[model samples]
Structures are given as structure tokens and as C-alpha cells.
Target: MKKWQLQDIRIRDPFFLKENGEYYLYGTTDVNTWEGNGEGFDCYRSKDLKLFQGPYPVFRAPQNFWADRNFWAPEVWKYRGRYYMIASFKAEGRCRGVQVLISDDPRGPFVPVTDGPVTPTDWECLDGTLCFEDDGVYMVFCHEWIQTGDGCICAAKMSGDLTKLTGEPEVLFHASEAEWPVIHREFDSEGFVTDGPFLFRDENSRLHMIWSSYGEKGYAVGISHAQKGVIGKWNHERNTVLEKEGGHGMIFEGPEGRTLLVVHTPNTWLKERVKLYSVEKLILGG
Candidate 1:
């Protein structure tokens, strides 16, 4: 019932989508994102990037929803005249995975379209992000280190209609493969962690991905470059894009047409809140 400024809302994995002249912000809304029976995701809308409105309940779990808790990283993508939200979910006796939900409007009571997660049922996966090319659509997500000693980012072919996955998940890279993640006991002592994997391209049309990991400064955002194409080889930038804690970022063009990177700050439990930075070079030009 309260409105929150960018510095007030306690949310992580912040994703911003600008559509039809309005901005929609979505992500892990729960403070206790690491555990829960999972509360459904929420959305915030605004005409300008500055002032905001409504927590605007976009999704709430139905009684029969497969994920009882740990609903996280919700990103909505508009495709073929409809909107689809790819988010991470978890439950007891089941592995954490990304699932698909649909809605005709960006702000909606989104409901699950797929029977369950498209990622392999046995693997611990999260942060499933959508990417498309002339060939087909793909979901690039993280293969969590909680399940694997070395966390990885994987890509899977999606059905043309975006309702289901069409093939096996292929590995793009791993936490160890990147050089930025700080060796922290809270995040990982023996291994590295891989969080939100969102795809984007710079002005030159060169593919770039901004993802979260523990850096020398604690939780941080790291940048990666595509060597060939969207699903091609990726190179982790030696330096982080944002190393001051708080990652799980998504890049979008603001109303003013400046490229902005939206991410949460602090990166602490119950303290994380959205923050925006000007980084136009991270976005593609028309």
C-alpha cells in the first residue's frame, strides 16, 4: 500500500522494460529471496524514469502453482503480440529452475503458460533470460553453483511460439571461466556463483551480457562480450562494469533515449533497492 523510491524498495535482480512509452520494473520482490514458498512477482510502472507508482501486483501464485517458494528474477519479454515472463522458482524436494508465464499486458495477473519449468528438472537453474536471432529464440540462464561446484551459464533453444523449450541446454560459460567474482565465503568459498544472466548489445551491435557475481567489492555486476554472435563465444571483461556491490542488472533505453543500467544497490539481505546508472555504450543503436 506504500509507494517506494528507487532507494526504498527492497528488491533484487532488477529488470526494466520500456514499452509504449511506459517503464515497467520487475524482479525478485521478496526480501528473503534465498528461501520461501515463493510469493508471486510484482511490477512498478512509470512514465518517466524519475517518479514511480504502484507495486502493482502483476503476479501472485495460484494454489496449484508448482513453485511453493523462492520465486525470483522475473523479466517480461514481448513477442508475437503478447508478453511472456521468464522467472526463477524453487520448491522443496525439487530443484530450482526457470519457468515461463504469460500475459497480454506488461502489468497483469500473469499466469503460468508452461506446465512447469523448461530447464532440466534435475538441475538447479535460475535467471532464465530470453534472446532471439534470425535462427530462433533461446533462453540464457544460470546453472547455479549450489548444484554444481562451478556455476555455468547455459543456452537452450526455445519453441517458436515461446511456450516450451525445444532442445538440450548448452553451456555458454562458468563462474570460474570469468575472472571477476570475488572469493567470498558468503557467496562461495570453494567455488564461484552465477546469478542473473541478461543479454544485450552495445552501439556497434556487439553482444554484451551483464550478470551478477561476488566481486572484489562483494556482490557486483560483471560484463561479458560475445566473440561471434548471440550464442557464440563470450569473453568476461577483466574489470567489472559495477564493482560496488548490487548487481543482477538489465539495460534498457530510458524515455530520454539515454542508455541506462538498472540494478539494485547494497546487495545486503533486506537492504537491496533499485539504482540506475547512465551507460549508453551498453545499449544498441537503431
Candidate 2:
């Protein structure tokens, strides 16, 4: 095993989780994330964002696992004394959807909590991110454009235990509703892609979501502010948060307490690498 710096690691949909002063990095870790047999997910730990150690194997598909490919966007959330990995999976005849995996430790052999995807089994969905609100726990995920000509971001209430979805999913917003995302004409003339819907708040505690889609410069990240609350009307920022072939980002408080954003850049297969940025700088520049 070898220790690698930030630039040395090649991953997509980079997710940052800080626990006990150490940073844990998780993402789409398979050698070929687009296709081929999915091997599961690996994690990296670092005291600082500069250097990291271990591609510690946190998950591997079991013999009975229903999904054999497209293991994408694994993000871990700590809730009720345990860590849950919200990730997406796919199979030949089955529709793509997100599932919940559980473990007592951050670095673990996580086991499936939900029998399969908590999202609707028949819908094409991905990037299931956990969001805790005063009312209840929720999972905000993308309904991919691959299935819908116009992609959407939706939210569904989860059981107190995070094991299963409690009710029908409600659409938060569609990719076409956002002003910044350009139609991915390559996929469909009217297609608009939606990926990585992550929830966060500003200093005012106003809820906002950052999601990825095609922009003027290929894959880009955009921020949308919720008008009422977590599941309220969302208004997209006129400009994208990151506009240069980088997307699928997540934000976290750095060790120094600075707000940081992490995204995979170049958005090209095998050429992607994690790029860290100051959220303040991005907002100021955008």
C-alpha cells in the first residue's frame, strides 16, 4: 500500500466527511466507473486535505448482491450511532436506484440495510444523499435524465431508523428549471442531466442544494436556494458554482473550520481527480 497526495488519487463524485478531526474521502472508486463489474467502494483518510493514506476497502459486493455494475457515488452519513452509506447501483434488467448500507465504523464492511434501493425500484435514480430536517429524515436524490427526458431532483421521507423510505418521493425541482444547466444534447435534444443533489445551509440557515449538470463548459456544479424550507421551491443561481468541466461536488467544514467544496475535475474517465476549493472563494468569484 502507498500513501498518496490529493492529486495522486483518481476518483469521481468525491464525498468528504470529517469525523474526530480526521477527514474521510469516499467516491466512485471502481477502476471503470461507467461500466464493467462493480467491485465495491474504497475510502481514504487524511489529517489534512493535502495528503491521504489507504484505499481501505470499505465495501465489496456480496455473492447474493442483486446489482453487479454501476456502483456510484458512495457517501457516508453518521446518524443515530451508526454510519450509513447512501449509494447507487444498477443491473441489466433492473432500473438504477440508490440503496442504504450500514456499518458501525466509518471504515467497514458495510452491509445492506434496505433489501434494495430505498428509492422507487422502478425509477432510474442515483446520488441518494441523506438530509436531516426538524420534521424528519429525508433522502435527496436525482432521477436521472437517462430515463426521463428532463431529469429531476426529488426527496422522500425516510423511517426514523434510516432503513427504508416511508412515503412517496416528491419532486423538488427539475434540471430544466435551473437556469445554468445547458441541455445535454448528446444524450437527448431535450435532456437535462441531474446528478449529486447535496443539501446544505448558509449562515442564515436558508436551505440550499448543490447539484451537477451540463453547463456552458461541460459538466458544472450549481447551487439552488430553497424558498420555503428543505422541500420548498428552489431557485437556481444565475451562475454555476464551478464551471470548468468539474462537478458532482460535496461541501464540508475543513479541519480549520473553513467551508470547503470538493469536486472531481476534467470530468473525463480515468483523468478525473479531486479538486478542493474554498466555498467563499467560489461564491465570491461566481
Top TM-score: which candidate number?
Answer: 2
**Model 1 per-residue lDDT tens digits across residues 182-210:** 54455444568898888887667777888
Among residues 3 or more apart in sequence or in different chains, the pairs in candidate 2 whose N, CA or C atoms overlap within 3 Å are none
Runs of candidate 1 exceeding 4 Å displacement: 1-3, 186-189, 281-286
What's the TM-score of every candidate structure?
0.93, 0.97
Query: By TM-score, how accurate is candidate 1?
Result: 0.93
Off by over 4 Å in 2: 186-190, 284-286
Candidate number with greatest lDDT: 2
Report the C-alpha lDDT of model 2 over 136-156, residue by residue, as the tens digit: 999999988988888999998
